[model samples]
Target: MSKLALDAAVFSDAAVAPDTRLVNDAIVKALRALGERWAAPLPEIRAARLSGTGTFPLPPESPRARVETIPGPRGPVPVRILMPDGAPKGVYLHIHGGGWTVGSARENEGLTSRIAANCGLAVVSVDYALAPEEPYPAGPDDCEAAALWLVNEGPARFGTQRFAIGGESGGATLAAATLRRLRDRHGLSPFAAAVLTSGCFDLRLTPSVRNWGELPLVLNTEDIARFVGNYLRLEGRADDPDVSPLLASLKGMPRALFTVGTRDPLLDDTLFMANAWLAAGNATELDVYAGGCHVFIGFPGTITDQALKRIDAFLTGF
Candidate 1:
């Protein structure tokens, strides 16, 4: 685990406060304390660990669109559809990041609402099944089903011009994989763009895995390994493009906005994926935040404002 290639200042603007280091340290301390507290109760521990600390509180009466549940192959899938008061500019199907094991639509309401409001797009947040329960193809299957449903049913309902997919962390990985599935199997091109924030593009362990000691914001390597192990059953299944989009051909993919924090273990994953996409001759934008940690997009008013601004600009152009 060598030092990161870029400096911390590249990720943050001068106007923003310079407390990322301290804030990240505090977050780590809290997580460590929480881990210690939950060490005895393993069953309750997964729930607590997955329920991240630091959440952006929503207003008591924040306007939100209706939540609908659509039937999937396995069972009923939940989706939160947020539309503007009137006409919408476009549609965005958002995925929540929870390491493919934990996280829900409710947990991601604030971020999705902000995206819908700021982008003037109808955002549909999908509540997919978690792994070690539903497993690998199950989560992706639900996501793809929801996305296909959006493409087939969204136009008549919302009257939007185009559709795009976006998410953070595991959600981002699902988004990328969904795009690939939609392209290869369904012959549908619903998304004109994508926004991947701190996405784990590669499921197979990378050099960054060894650098976990230096990254205070990410979960330990053991936890990450456990996640990957549970997500994929076969030995070499992780390299499959469906699980690791970085291993897939990037040709004809939509223009993308890749965002990552410097302090995250997946920082290299984001950079590698961005470069691969660019080298494959696809239009891509990379925005790296210095001293920030994994899934920093959810930490609004902190180090994520600038990255969110960049995302807003990218989606608007598309």
Candidate 2:
């Protein structure tokens, strides 16, 4: 059976192994815990700022991470580089998600470092500018600058021109926008693959975001609005492809693996983007995990384990 057909069995969790499940009871409890933490009502736009989630404890300081300040269109952008070993097979550019507000490159150390260590890829994670202060174009501009630097200097520095880009939540929006900028303006096709996870593709609040308000999500409709509002305060339009990648042309973009959960508020974003990619005659794979809230791949457990394994497999092919 094709992978799509296999999904039926995987989701059912009957004829498949333990690591893969569409819905697990543990995920439900995890979601509920998160809901309780965010029990306070949404803050006003002016008063809104990302809640204190503390930096993820730094991973083992091995393989040594290099923090560098690169000149971006908006002056400077910080990037974290993690290389597992010498002579990496490829370089992976990872963009982090925190509603374009409260996340840093080290937030993805657990994921990016593993990818670098096991997959023989150098992982470059961008610390893009946050919104409400920098907003819209600043985030995309920084990401674009990072991509441009990688394409120009990566081969000489990392010894590999083969690269892929991916992001989650707000970062995914920036990643997709960066890819479009690379393709449309620079005539670049350096990405061998793309991975978008639980991304908000539409800034106008797509139907999924509109309907998932009462649902217990790490990101719900109200939070979505606040993030988008903060981002657009400067100049991004809701329908502009850069702000809403779903509205962008997917033509000539690299093959992508799109992941989202059934209960995720951004479910429709992934579905819509995946369909558009396939419709544009590009390779696409869509995986929908049942009962999962927004961006569960980073969450520790069986589901994250399987998702990372899946990510590793996808990179092997690229």
Candidate 3:
């Protein structure tokens, strides 16, 4: 069966496994605890992150992983590059997610390295500027700069001209914006595929996000609004096409794989964006995992394994 068809069977009431149920219950409890903790001030949250409090263990950074500086709109942006054992078939530009605030490429090496190995592609993870200090155009500008550089230099750097871009949550938002910027601003259509997981496409607040309220499966409606406010730093800039790719023309965009959980507040965003992508004459795959909360792919379980394998297939297929 196809992956989507398998998902239907696995998620059906009669077919759900006990392990999956237990995993879902555990995820809910953990997310609720995290919700309470993340409700603290941004500084406190960042401090906890820096202190490694309440963070899960990740695999050690890959041996082949290395950090490099790339030219950006403001200054040099740091990128963490990971290469597979042999010559890579292509490149995957990864954007890390922290609500446009608190994530670094070095910290994401574990995930990026795994992707590099699995997809047989060199993974270049961009450490974009954060918000509330470098708000509005800073993060997007940096991401765009990285994409431009990769398009211009990746063949010589990696021995392949094929490329893909992807990210999760806020990073996914930036990835989509970067693709549009490349097409519209630079007159380039360089990426062959894209992977967006649980991204909030419409910063004006999609129906699912607006209706999510304070449930806090991972992010509450209020939390999303706050993050968007911090990034835009304006009252009504969410509607700008540059800020929200959902409002932009997606014509000439590359093939895309979109993954989201049914329980995620960004469900509507993925649904709408996938439809928009198809409407704009692109191949779009929307994978909705049952009982998954936001960013569930980072966790262990059959579902996470399935998501990762699907991602590998997508990126490696070129």
Candidate 4:
């Protein structure tokens, strides 16, 4: 593959980090080798690669962790709960990212545990339904149910009513949609803050997503298109506010932190959504990390540490 090239202005607002680019380059090489080794289709390969059953061992889960089920719009939604050292002051609902196809609540226990411990809050991670099997409404519906349950039942269970929501990649999109659903359907906006990382807020691909050719930056144009197709299943659903939060009314939404890497295909999504969130009278913070790729937070590096610090500060403030 060719080396990545972008206008210097493209990363004008990005953090000056040094290790993300190298880490992402290594990831790209591994991905290419995996594709060559596997004979399955791209979707199957991707699903298997991200299914939380791969060879990679995730960061360890917190000692104070448990799994439980709560009532959802469709049925019982399983959630992984992590608690801090003492009685919590608030609750944080975390959504896992996997392009709406693969991933589980247990997959991100390490991150959730850190959030729980650092923020002095109970962390609940949702294991929502996936696409090509469960599809768009299923994932969103499950997330909405989790949020509603947290709003209505969390205090009784965790001793606090304060709430925050966040997710990565497709999960971030679902988190945004869930917030909108709460605002419009239930006439509620109870979240203290939102952290959206590398979310594809617009189903209709942005210029960066559409124009990003095959460069070994973790995700190319085709990969994103495939993920969107799997999630939506049919065409013409891109404009719905539920499907694309960028097209939704951001008024009454919680204070949000939009994060993305300059090398990610969804860079424009963060850029555009942050502006829209601010313009719609909501407080918004944008963080662009130079040379970081899609889901760069998963890679341990200086940028990831900085981003987590920023996220911890953002959430702890509320």
lDDT of 1 at 61: 27
Model 3 segments more than 4 A misplaced = 1-17, 34-44, 234-236
The residue-by-residue lDDT of candidate 4 on 1-318, one tens digit each, is 111223566476454455665687688787776664325654665555445446345667568789899998778899999998999988999999878876777778778888988989899999998887777788999999999999988889999888999999998999999999999999998898899999999989999999999774667888788778888884328889999999999998888888888889999998889888888887778887777788788888888888899889988987
Q: List the residue pairs that clash in candidate 2.
A: none
Q: Count the backbone clashes (under 3 Å) in each candidate.
A: 1, 0, 0, 0
Better of 2 and 4 by TM-score: 4
lDDT of 4 at 138: 89
CA lDDT of every candidate: 0.77, 0.78, 0.83, 0.83
Per-model TM-score, in order, reads 0.87, 0.85, 0.90, 0.90
Query: Best lDDT goes to which candidate?
Result: 4
- Residue 217, candidate 3: how far off, in angstroms? 1.8
Off by over 4 Å in 4: 1-17, 36-56, 234-236
Task: Give the Å error, residue 19, model 2.
Answer: 10
Q: Which rank order by lDDT, best down to worst?
A: 4, 3, 2, 1
CA lDDT, candidate 2, residue 125: 94
Quote the positional error of residue 289 for candidate 4 in Å: 1.1
Q: Write the per-residue lDDT of candidate 2 for residues 1-318, one digit (tens) a residue.
A: 113322554334354334433334455455566545334543432123322232123344435478988889868789999987768899999999988866778766777888888888888999998877888888889999999999989999898888999988888888889999999999988998988888989888889899877544466677788888888997789989888988988899888988877667888888888888888878888877755567888665566677788888888678
